[model samples]
Target: MDTLPDPVGSSQMDIETSQAGGTPEVANSAAKPRVRAPVRVEEAPKFDLDTYIANYTGRTRYDRLYLIGTCSPSLANEALKAAIAEAKASKDIIKYEKAVRALSEVAPSDPEATLNSAWVQETQRSVNAQTERLEGELKGYKNNLIKESIRMGTEDLGNHYYRTGDLAAASKAYSRVRDFCTTPNHITSMLFKMVSVSIERGDWLSVQSNVHRLRNSQSKPEDAARNEPKIAAAWALAQMQQGAFLEAANSFLAIPADLGDSYNEVLTPNDVAVYGGLCALASMNREELQRNVLDNQSFRNFLELEPHIRRAIAFFCNFKFRPCLDILESYRPDYLLDVHLQRFLPQLYKRIRTKSIEQYMIPYNRVTLDAMAKIFAPSVIGGEAKPTDISSPFVQELIGLIQDGVLDARIDMEKGLLISNQVDLRSEVQRSTLENFREFNQEAHWRILRAQVLYHGLEIKSDKKFGDGGKGARFSREGAGFD
Candidate 1:
């Protein structure tokens, strides 16, 4: 929570001060930075490049690989080369050119960086020929006035446009298929194509809109069973992008682990595990984590694929803060390189860290600043305590927690301690009671006054005596809130 210039290390504390007992007092928070391990951006993630890439297909593969190529310095050249190869294999000249540009930026000496005008010209000619052919076919089908033939023609054209990376044209072509759709499956297929287009375009709201349409479509039980996992993953991705971590976790948790690579074009079981698990950690309580994640039999299969994430949840549930946090820290770099996770990582990690701080303080009513610092903001060298001074990041975090009401605790600066405050129930009740009585008295007076006005039938006429002609109005007890 502290905006320190130094790289963020895994340290969290919530500080407030108490003059006598548990009452909070505001104090200026300052933090002194102690050395912590600078995050190693070059650290390669646990998975191998080829194996990981093989888990996905379609544009997602390029997006993910390119993201890694751009974000992870250690994997840049390999990822960029892989991306270029994949792009070149596709009919999409746009994809190929984009990948070539990235490779040129990262590894100019690499052969893939070359524009390869020969391949470009060939793809250009092919794309033009294919587009004209598909368009001509669609025109013929339309002239025949056959709905099914028209639908087929439109879908073929959409597929052509998609392959050529003309997403706008592809999306329009796919949408055209909808009007010609004669059955549930046709509509479903059209919707799916639109979803893919929306996802590639980073249009999350469209993804959600189409997923909603898909869910409500007339799919049979078997179809639902086969498609539910894909739908859930897509919906979860949209929710994640929308910043609804808890809702996204619930959606992800609902995904059946048997999904395997069925949704590999957009997501994988490993992704389900990582995205769902991190979202859970950021938003769910220990009990919730246990119930929805560690104990959910249906999702256990996905968890098995990413055991590190499972262990992180387990550690957090067990209140093993240090190890839990360390695990998250180690994996942060990998998640940072993820296409979908990169933008949301800051918010997700912040929530997880803040929640960890809250959980750590749950069992303590009074704890020393040294003790808090040892667990949070520890010196990376020997796990030493950070300075309890106002300048300490640890102290600053505590200051934030106090101000934000995330922690009901106070700091005793001279004593170098955190003193927790329990809500004074008696005071709170008395305050509420006093406020309620005042409201009741005011209501009773207004009602009695109204009764007098009604009894006397005093229909006061508007007069200039009122500063604003319409300002002074009589109570119509009928329109009053209490009424």
Candidate 2:
């Protein structure tokens, strides 16, 4: 995010968290509000639950499925069912219970929603026994003062804590392992734990910090290559979460290809494409979009996963604004269901639309309001639901953009056109020249004053006039002695 380097040949990347192993651990305690029937509604998300889930493995599968279930009522039953199956296969009873509870709310008749007390009890016992055993082993390692053993032991405990959904405990355990790390791999492993904890906890700042810590680590070249895509994706995720869209775009674009399914525990290649493409469209200009997006060889592989994003970018680059926007709108519902993207989707779309409008007017002195409305606000124009007038939403948006200095065009309601406030380059250059000359003259005067003072060996000294206790004495500089 900070560097926004080129996608290919960049050394920066991201990876590993509590679900750092075969299973991911998230905060099971943080309750979420349940969403009503998602698929049952007329506005169903176009996202395929099975296909999206296929991109991930380990604990993230359950985490994402649980999120989809809770948030999208249409997908709730299917998502929660898959989440339950994942939890059943794992020892995370807290997660199992949560999923079961949520499912019961959504589909009480579904047998999977019925919490299995026996499984919960058995898992609880297994977890307790494992925790005690790991704690004992960690104590023995600490007593022996074995750095590697202690580090491993701490990580085990941390992973266990993570699995049990003890987020605070897991974070603490992960942090402790850093003190005992003895190698680059060790440091990398420890940093991954920290990143995972922070990610699951929604501590984006901490996630970025850990990513930088690893990015700056002295890992072997081969290992760094293996982990680069994920860390970069993770960093970009943090950047996106923090509303640093353009910075996030650069980080996402910087992620190399050939990652395949290796980094899917947190993010899929499709995520990289979707996230990077949208952000680039929203932030980057046409030239940047062309060079960094459409022409980016490394990112091209990721773009292949979602050809729609590629088409959107191509459409945008080719000045086909309405088609580009239409494609995005068609996918909005599905994108809205994405856990990381939902919060920023509205902002991203708004930015893309405004930028398109801004770009559309760049070559023109003026455009008819009708033309602008059709391109930017087609739904609101000439519809009984929204009156076609100066007071309409499209006009309001234009007004806001104009007022905010984002658009250099203004509405000429009398003529029904948006007129560009074009600049006279000759006058602008003359004005710039005058300002520079004034600045130089002012600087020159100061320089002369300083030179004269220095030449005269100016020094401050108190000169007594005729006053008690030097009260009447004033400090004066021995100056150029001007007559």
Task: Give the top-scoring candidate (lDDT).
Answer: 2
Instruction: Give one digit per residue, the lDDT tens place, for model 2 in 1-483.
Output: 122111101112111122234222232332121222322223567778898898887667887787677667778899889988887786766567667777888899999889899988788788778889999999999999988899999999999887766667788899998899888999998898788778776788899899999899999999999988878888999998899889989998899897677777678888889999999999999999999988989999999999999999999999999999999999987887676776688899999998999889877778998887788877866574534476787788889999999988678888888898988566788999999999999888877876887678775555556443576766455433421
* TM, every model: 0.78, 0.78
Full-model lDDT for every candidate: 0.77, 0.78
* Candidate 2 local distance difference test against the native: 0.78
Could you give candidate 1's per-residue lDDT for residues 1-483 as a string of tens digits? 122111111112212221224211111111221222223357878778888888888878877876777667788889878877776777655556556665677678988788899987787787778878989999999999999999999999888777656666788889989899988989988999999988776678999999999999998889988988888899999999999999999999998766888878888998999999999999999999999899999989989989999999999999987788888888887888777887788889889989998898777777887777767666632532347787777788889989999988888998887888986666788999999999999999978887787788764533456543367754443555323
Angstrom error of the Cα, residue 166, model 1: value is 1.0
